[model samples]
Target chain A: MEIAQSLQQVKSSYIREILAAASDKNVISLAGGLPDEKTFPIDLMKPTLENLANMPEVFQYGSTAGYGPLLSFLNGYFQLPETHTAMITTGSQQGLDLIARAYVNPGDKVVMEAPSYLGAMQVFGLVQANIVTVSQTEFGPNLEELEQCFAEQKPKMFYAVPDFHNPTGVCWALETRQKVAELCIQYNVAFIEDAPYRELRFSGEALPLVSDFCPQNSIVLRSFSKIASPGLRIGVVTGKTSYLEPLIKIKQGADLHSSVPMQALLHGLLQHNNFATHITTICELYKSRYDVMYAELEKQLPASCVLKPVDGGMFVWVEIPECDTFELAKSLLANGVAVVPSPVFYPEGSAVKAALRLNFTNATPEELTVAVTRLADVLNAL
Target chain B: MEIAQSLQQVKSSYIREILAAASDKNVISLAGGLPDEKTFPIDLMKPTLENLANMPEVFQYGSTAGYGPLLSFLNGYFQLPETHTAMITTGSQQGLDLIARAYVNPGDKVVMEAPSYLGAMQVFGLVQANIVTVSQTEFGPNLEELEQCFAEQKPKMFYAVPDFHNPTGVCWALETRQKVAELCIQYNVAFIEDAPYRELRFSGEALPLVSDFCPQNSIVLRSFSKIASPGLRIGVVTGKTSYLEPLIKIKQGADLHSSVPMQALLHGLLQHNNFATHITTICELYKSRYDVMYAELEKQLPASCVLKPVDGGMFVWVEIPECDTFELAKSLLANGVAVVPSPVFYPEGSAVKAALRLNFTNATPEELTVAVTRLADVLNAL
Candidate 1:
């Protein structure tokens, strides 16, 4: 069959595919970056449904930009009163897809941190953008490498997960964030700050969004998936009005709008409950799980294995020296455990293969301990 | 400030934009192709939500292909037991968008009816496809013109709403569907069967889908929005396994997946309730509303105005001689009525300008009567 040339270049989302394959009842899966379902505020949803049922228009199609009330609430929640415009999306993933569709013409240049979120990279790939990657530093993306990539590639946009960055689980320091914002302004490149994990921070005080510093040129994507329910599929995009208007137009042609009932439910939850406090509870839960997983990995894993403690977010990044993570993942799965190989997160055929991402949020403490022991056994056998 | 060249060619959805503008309290809107809110099975949804509450997984991130039970239900409902694959989408609109992204490369040829669904046209435009429009007949798209288009353009695909075709409200006869399917197969052109309005038929038995006639190369998109609840935003696409597999991959990259709670609610509604019987009741309700609007148009419209009595679907297409629908729609709005200008439904700068699409489904009988009378007044003044 003659597939589109662009599709020939496009690969299936690795994390999603691996998670699907390993979702058996016995597997202690760490492949999916899923939020803890146990922490979902089920009691709050009852009142939310009641509120939606009361509103007659809740069942009707909403504005393409989003439900106006939800957008207003998001704007206030983000505390961007003056220069920001917010639009709701199906999820933060859709926000990235919309931005890709709007700004990326075929063969356009887009830069991102190496080993960034696989989903965002998949979106950029679909648009046939030429992806340039900068190395990941302990703080955030390597500033010098980014500057060099910017000068050489002159990319149209830079995509980042500055808040508790995915896979690496390293949040950008306030200084690094300020520097990146200034560089985006200097280079005339658009910045897409994906902050889906910002609210999940457990250790440090939350830093101001990159958008707060570079108000005119950056867009920040936030989702309720981490806090409330991923099943609701609600997210918000906040940015300068000029960029947001175009995104709204793209969204109109995408799905017309996100699910209205879900939007109404989210609005109801926000209005009626202390959603912020609930998110805090979720953070504490994940923090304890992260600690458990980190401690178990240290006690059980081989001396060659290095584990990075996740300050926030769902994943703990692990590096295995001189070992194929993919093979280790398969052996771990055979032993009733699942972990995602990080090589799939890089560009296709890239040289990064020794890293793996293990999710700490989905499994229980006992399960995490068992999974780590199983992983250690697999590593030792290899 | 610089818009993409692709966006320059893409216009806002005429129905959605006009409907938003006509949301004034005084405006008796007959422009939106939205299903009646009163017809929404709200009573059923309460129990459905209760069922969802019992299933903890309903609030978690579901499979990218869909919620498994919903896909299984759809497969059984559509009778695609063999040689078929199904995936859930945000809506049928998103399905079309995915097909466009996956199949239609720049300058790829695509075919549509002369006055087709505006949303599909907008998607094709965004993909930079060269669109060729075939004329329309009462039965459906003109088979002779479609044959000619296939011969001349060799389009990559043809998009059609064979069942109660939008704006025109014309159902394709069985013979027409078979002939069109045969031609597509002969030319190896993909057929996109959009059947959102299929279940809304007021009378006459349902015709077999084009996919039934030619399963090897056709994709069928069905939506629960019209019959059940648009607020849930659940829709499905079924087609040959070969083609659908790639589309499912594209969908995974697009939005991760549709809402899990929405799909769970739909699955519950389908399993626990007599949805077919509910749809029959809805058809009866729409039939009466359709008759009321038809009679009112006959009595109140200008002598020069021509209206084709539609068997099903929400809209009534009307042509007023020597009157531009854009101007007339503005005049009608001033007179506290709303209708969509027909030109917006056509390809860019098409010659079809003197027609309007008045929706009878969304308005009450009294509201329809008053709106039609006001429309007549506007036509008379013009």
Candidate 2:
């Protein structure tokens, strides 16, 4: 059967494909943007599930928007004033899919940071949107390039990670965020800020969301996957009332709503448990792990290897000049260490072939030491 | 902001709008395709949640295809004698959406029943498919018209409900299923047989699905929502190996997968409890409610009212000649009763508008009796 022409353009995430082929006994996987399972609030979750089981209405069909109490809880969490609205989604991924369906038409232009999260690019591609990419600097997305893309494409929307951005672990400075907000206002383009890892910061005080700078044209996406459990599939979208209303409609047309029982479980966890305290402990744990991984890299890697210290988020981006990250990844897999090539995080067939992303969160200190030693051996052999 | 052009072609479900506006306290809602909350296997579910709570792994990220045990269980359910592959989805709604994204391209020909489930129509619209509707008869879709459509349009696929079909309550006879399967095979068109209500048959032995007749060209969808709980949002799809591979990729790209915790809960329910026995009791309860509604309609409806007996399923189709069903629905809503006008289910906006769909599953016998009496009175006044 002839499939959708748009599907011809849909490419699988290269990292995911490589991770799938690696053996559990040998592979030290850093290919997936996965949270450390050890930090999952299982103790809190058990009681939460018990509470949900006791609530008779929790097991039935919920409103197409979400469970009311959960939505109310999210509204409080996001600190949205009475004027703004919030809706819970299956995950941040579903939030991205809903935004695409709601706002993007065929041939409509959508702007994104050049090496942004691959999942969002796949979704925009499925919607048949003409994608325009802007380069990213250590501070954030290149402001000049962003303005140029906005001026040239007049994109229907701009999707970005404003805080502790994925793959790069670079947060947008407050000034850069302000400039982006002003540009959105100037161009009348919607700004979609996805901040799934905001709460995972190890050291600095959190920055204000880009949405706070331009509330009228911004939508902020938050996920419990990084802090709680991805299995529960809990996420929320906060934005202006006008945008949220249509997103709710698109969500209704998607999967009716996110899992109601899961929402109830999450609500119980938030209300009854010391969720903030739990997340603080998790951040400390990840911070220690990141320190261990950083030390291992310094001790074991070649002097030519260069990496920017990740302030927050799960991954550390490493650049090995003139070496193919994909080939290096395969060699590491053979040596029992798994790391994702950087190109998977970029648009299909991008030129960022010399970089690789390593995740420190999912591995233990001993494992990280051994993995880094093996990775150094692979690089030396190359 | 300009929304997607495809959305302009997508019509919001009229039934959803009516249900939203009508007061819950006074309204006898027949507009929702909802299962009886009273009949939900609550006892079975409590233990299921307990079992899931005992296993923390259930609360972590699962394979994109789905949880392994649930997929294996569904494969057994569908492919008893021979092995087949199955993928879990958010709901049967997501199943339709994935199929649309994977198969339909702009202006691609797709066939559906004239007065079909509105959700399916919404999905096809998103993909910009040229939808052709085949008239539905008492036994099933008019095979003659379907063949004519196939000959003329060379449609890529035909979507239908063969068992306890929505609104119409018509199950395709065994012979009709075979003939439709043969025709689809001959024309090399895919068949999507959605069987959400198959387990809810009040009487009669189960007829084999169209996929049973033409295994190579059919994809069968089954859901735990109608039988268990829609809040959990778990559904399964089974088809040939060739088709299953691409769908696995599509499901991965869509939302990673459905909720893992829900899949675990469902697996516990299926294994540890008499779920089939519970469904039997629920079906009998709905059958009683169906009888009560039919008796009330026979006694109180105007002489001009045309009614069709529903053997099983949630709805009853009623036609009132020379009166617009939409206007009648409004009058019924004013009188504190709700029904979905049939025109909303049709593809063409200008199609027949004299019928209304009444659901008998969600209300008690006394409530249904009172609601139908009020409905009859409103029709007489109209």
Candidate 3:
């Protein structure tokens, strides 16, 4: 049977393919936006794990919105307004997929910063959205360009990772956040704020979610993958109750709901006294690794290549002289390192920027040092 | 924001809404197709649950296809051929959603027997598939009509619950299975065999899946929801390698993957020595419940309301004298029993038989007895 036309344009995620290759024992993989497995607070989860056996109710069918206890706990945790609500998803990635399917029509304009999260592009692409791109500055999307895109394209939504983005790790400035929220409210374009890396802030004070400024005009996706566990595949989407109800409808078809045991486990962990400290611990651990990689790149990289220091999140973007990035990535892989080429993060056929995204969270300081050396050697030859 | 045109036509699941109503303490809900919570083999899952804290790897992102060990184990567990493969879904509900999203384009014809699974109808409806239905008989789908529909409509797929079918509980005759498979292959139509209840059979000899008759022409969806646990929200879709790959692609965007820890826990539970015994235990237990419900309906239900005894599965369909099923169901709910109106099972605006689907699984025999009395009084009044 022919695959659906919607899926025809969606190439399987390149990062996933590269992540698979990066799994080789000899390779130091910075290709995936993976939280370090060692940082998973299994100790904090032990009580929940042991107690799960006694909670047979979780083993039965659950509500599509989420487990009631988890949903109630999140209301207090997020301090959501009375008018707002939350729905659980298999992951924040699924949260994006649900949003796209819920609101996006074929040929609907969906605005995103160029070099945005690849997974977001894939989800929007699956819905056949006309993905409009805005240029990214050091502080989120270029404000002038975003305003222009909103005015001209009349996009249905603006999707972004406002806090420590996936590929670039560019946290939106507070002014940028407020202005973007204002523009979205003025233009009626929903702001889809994806905050998977929000809590991973180690070196900077956290800013409010852009959605906070335009609560009724935006949806926020929060992920536990970075802080708690990706293996749990649990995510939360919060917005006006009206905005989230449609997503819940689509989610009913998407997966009924995410795993109840996982939700219960996450609820238990989130309530644990040590959970906040656990986040700080992983954040510090990741910051140290990032320091090593950043230092090595500063010390050893060729002058032609530009490097930017990230305050948080897993990756650092390295701008290279215009070259075939896929080939560069392939060569880096051959040298026992894995990094995602920048093109994968952009919409297909968009002007390709020659760059690579290197992750620091999954690898150790020594591995980060060696991986950066391999990366530098490859760049030096170029 | 306007919802996607695709979702505009879709309605929130009627069954889910009624299931919510059924949650009232005074309501004995046969509205939901939920297995008995007691039937969940938490004991079988205990060893795996305790071991989960030690396996930090499960806390990390896993392959989009599935957890490695689970897929490999299912390969052996199902004894799938060398040409076949499996992909895990959040639930069998999601397996259907993926199939619909991956393959069924809008306006594409997909065939199902009338009085089919509501979830299947919801999924196909979400994709905006042109759902063409043929009449169902006591033996299965009317063979002559199925062949006629296939030949004329040239549907993309034939979706069915071949073993202990939903709502109508019409398990196909062996000949019907062979003929459906033959017609699908001959018509170049794919067969989507959703066998969630295949393992729930309490009587009659187990038969080979319709897919077994034409392996290359079919995809089989197997659910652990009924047997293992729905709260885990894990299900498997298996078919030839080529047939299954597109689903994995759609699944990557669906939720990245099912919960890895849940997948690992499911994997470990599947490997437990008592797992097979657990299935037998549930089958026996549900059989007793089914016997009670069937007996009560046979003894007390008016002759005007025709009842079909199911060999297995959670429901028994009662074809009442032509009347408004929705009103009847509502009145029954008011009298402290909750059942699904049959119209929800058919495609929107399709001619709905004046019948109701009554679940026999979740409630105890005593509850079932009282629920049937309530149902009988309502129907007798109607």
TM-score of each: 0.97, 0.97, 0.99
Docking class of 3: high
**Candidate 3 local lDDT, B273-326, one digit each (tens):** 999999998999999998999999999999988888778887899898988888
C-alpha lDDT (0 to 100) for residue A8 of candidate 1: 86
Model 1, residue A326: C-alpha shift (Å): 2.0
Q: Residue pairs in steric clash, candidate 2?
A: A28-A338
Writing each residue's lDDT as its tens digit, candidate 1 over A311-377 gives 7988888888776677777888889888888787787645584877888888898989988888888
Error of 2 at B91 (Å): 0.8
Best by lDDT: 3
Q: What CAPRI class is candidate 1?
A: medium
Worst 10 residues of 1 chain B by lDDT: B45-54
Q: What pairs collide in candidate 3?
A: B90-B233
State fnat for each of the candidate structures: 0.57, 0.64, 0.92
The 10-residue segment with the lowest total lDDT in model 3 chain B: B344-353
Ranked by DockQ from best down, the candidates are: 3, 2, 1
RMSD in Å for all candidates: 1.8, 1.6, 1.0
- Judge candidate 3 against the unseen true structure and give its global Cα lDDT, from 0 to 1: 0.90
Candidate 3 lDDT, A204-292, residue by residue in tens:
78899999999999999999999999999999999999999889888888788889999999999999999999998998899999899
| Each prediction's DockQ against the real complex | 0.64, 0.70, 0.89
